[model samples]
Target: MSEAWNEGYFTDVGYTYGYYREINPVFQRFCLLLRGLAQPEPAEGTRHCELGFGQGVSVNIHAAANPGRYVATDFNPAHAAHARRLAAASGSEALLVDESFEQLLERDDLPQFDSISLHGIWTWVSRDNHEVIAEFARRHLKPGGIFYNSYNCFPGWSPAYPLRQLFALHDRFGVTPNGAVERVEAALKFSEALLAANPNYLKAAPQLTERLKSIATQNRHYLAHEYFNREWNCMYFTDVVDALAPAKLDWACTASPLDAVDAVNLAEPAQTFLKGVDHPILREQARDYFVNQQFRKDLYVRGAIRLSVAEQREHLLDTRFVLTQPADQVPMKVTGALGEASLQEDLYKPFIEALAADACAPKTLRRLAAGFSGMAWPVLQQIVAVLTGMGAVAPCQPESAEREARTRCRALNRHLCERARYGNEIEFLASPLTGGGISVPRFQQIFLLAREQGRKQPAEWAQFAWGMLDAQGQRILKDGKALESAEENLAELTTQAGEFAEKRLPVLKALGVV
Candidate 1:
């Protein structure tokens, strides 16, 4: 195994330094899809396993939302520790094991999991590692369990593979991390020069320019780890299918529901011609011709069981009501041919109006649909999809008045950045583990004062800062309407700040300068 495969290296630098904790909605939706497919519900104490649980953010969120036992494993000990901490903090009932997939599969005490997920690992690991993961799924996944895997694909990524190779060569030649970055920059500059020198470069220059720009935007740490990693590779979707065939797993569906919608897939005469092809490899080729896919989230199942459309509807109903948007917000008017037009025709006006009023909770939408008398779950779902597609609706967790107050305070802090005294205070308020995490109410009070007397910025940090604060505040306000009052908001902010001070202040103190 490479040194990167060792537990210590990943723990000491990889998981701790990177911004790896952001929520992945694709994985979350996959879980919901699994929940639907596993209907006629599994026996109690059903479990799910995540093969490479880096930082445990995705699995923790899934475990929190779904009622099941979760077993997560990572080859990196640091990742396992971080995952454990996250699980505990989030009150997620997930068991974290610091072991490779191979070692985990060899254990006799493990139970067959109802679902298995592996993300961002398959394309970056050795073939042996792939075999181990496949073998583990074969041995431990229940007969009808679902397996989800996401990876980089061919054709779309083929153009960039050479660029990656060039970067790897530079990384090998460079002495320091910054030197490696400079070397990559130099290589990109050379490519630009080459394109400028040759008129023939026009055909390939666009792709090269895009690749260069992408690498330029990437974080230094991410660039080093991603390109320098010894095992990075991309595979064809069909090749991945062939690799997993030995494990008796078969493709259930593509993770994206939008991909499955016939209208989206069948647009041209060529699409119709391609759909009739029986061979899986041919189908994939046709798909590539139709769409140059760069990545895919594939869902696989062990058995051949299929669900009826009605069963799928019931399963969708069983999904927990996750509020993606406020209840009163109205959706934008649809001028085009809406999918399942009959379903959307009657409710389109009302749905748009309701969505416009305020962003709505999913439950509130359902209630509104029921009142419409002509509404069906499918129709409502489609409307919600349309609204979501339009960016009119969002999922929000209920917040208290205190949370609202804090958001206002944060906004105030940003605007005050031009005033040296207030700017310093704003920086303190904006610290992630400290001020950023503080309760809304107290932050609100501080912000109100700052806003009244703060210096005006010659530039627009306040605008950028407001954008961030507004997004956070919108989430809180939409989720928890309880924090609407000024007094309630203030109280909540105070409590939040106190909690932050207690839990995160020590780290801040140790770091010293602020």
Candidate 2:
């Protein structure tokens, strides 16, 4: 019998997948680098394939933006089904396959793709499967095709690997879920006690105690899942480069271009040290180690092709910002009559106003929160996501240098937050566990699920929402209690129904059924 792949097991024993909502600019840049390698235009309909197309959200977004004959494949039937549903919902015309990489490669009937992307699947699969992936790229990838693969990297993750092994051992011993949590907590506590016992703990690094303390406080689900995966392993960058050498593939660029930003990029001395490195793999590893890289997304190319940075920038200039026409300028695509009626008694006016800003970027929305100190960050983030989905604002390019600077600054903040102790709480709450806000497609979903069903209200929610709205109305509302007066109750329900109407009305409008 084929080995059973239990999702609960994966959830209980593997690292949770990173759920990024927006189009990753780094992936876009990688595509530009590939286009330069292939000498192709966006209008040329380059054939692209994605391996392990989880949920197909990114593929759908790409298909909507770039017209192409795209193909996607995944081994999990459930995941493939979800991808198909999303594609259908998004009206994207792309072929999705449910099969293994080996089987797909063996088929002569398949179309030759110009680019193939495999993100977050390299280290999780068996070694033989990894070889098959490389072999498929060799035989099927066009001579100048671009292949992007993202995987866990080494040296930085070395200390964590032993912890993972211990978790795996405990998991095999039939430890209860809570037991697993306790065991990890105990391990961390023991580590802390040892440090306390020896005041010379700073002899190794004073920061070590703080780091362990931070890890212990991370989400229990995250800890249990990531540290107990059976196949969790980290390989040196050289090992990965060698693995791809047989297929004549070479590291073209990084999927996350921000990772390329470092002291090496800043100083002549660091640059010279990087240059003297002979092996491409070793050079990357050295740079990563110096900077302490934990995760990576790298782009590989079959052959070398040169393009200037300016040319690359021009290629990526299409539809990079979200545009919103003034409320009166364009006919409201969504029915806001109900929203307007409900707006009279509800205290979410400031929250709604922030969402209604002519055409604000996410960064601007965040910065604007300072003006509304009582407003919660999580609530504001969700409100922005809801408005974006409702067609109140559309995606556009970040036009100003200020926006770019803010983006980089935010990334640096994220890096520092990942390594620090007290900052871990901020990182955890900002992540998907607290609904990163942008990931929620509709406001009604938040209302019906979080408000009506009495979900999403926790100590964290209060902390999260306090950053979005004024203090007068920031109190945690129990299920039906969110609707206080009859006026407020009717308004809340009406707003909820209106949101659904707004979403469904677009389809009718497109079909001339409205």
- Number of colliding residue pairs in model 2: 19
| Minimal lDDT window, size 10, model 2 | 428-437
Task: Estimate TM-scores for all models.
Answer: 0.64, 0.57
Give the runs in model 2 whose Cα sits over 4 Å from its true position: 1-26, 30-39, 177-225, 263-269, 275-280, 308-514
Model 1, residue 305: C-alpha shift (Å) = 1.7
Clashes of each: 35, 19
For 1-514, candidate 1 gives per-residue lDDT tens digits of 3464562222224442221111222233433343245422433366888887665655654444344467889887777886676566535457899888778888998888887888777877778888998898888888877778888888768766766676555545644344645654665555455556654545764577666776778665456555656677688888888898877887766655445433434556756887699985668656755566778777777874666767666555444232222223333343221233222445566665543332222334444555566676666666555453343333222133123223333343333333332222222222111111211232333333343454232112233333334445621242546555444544544464454344333332221111
What is candidate 2's CA lDDT for residue 36? 47
Best by TM-score: 1
What is the C-alpha local distance difference test score of each model? 0.53, 0.49
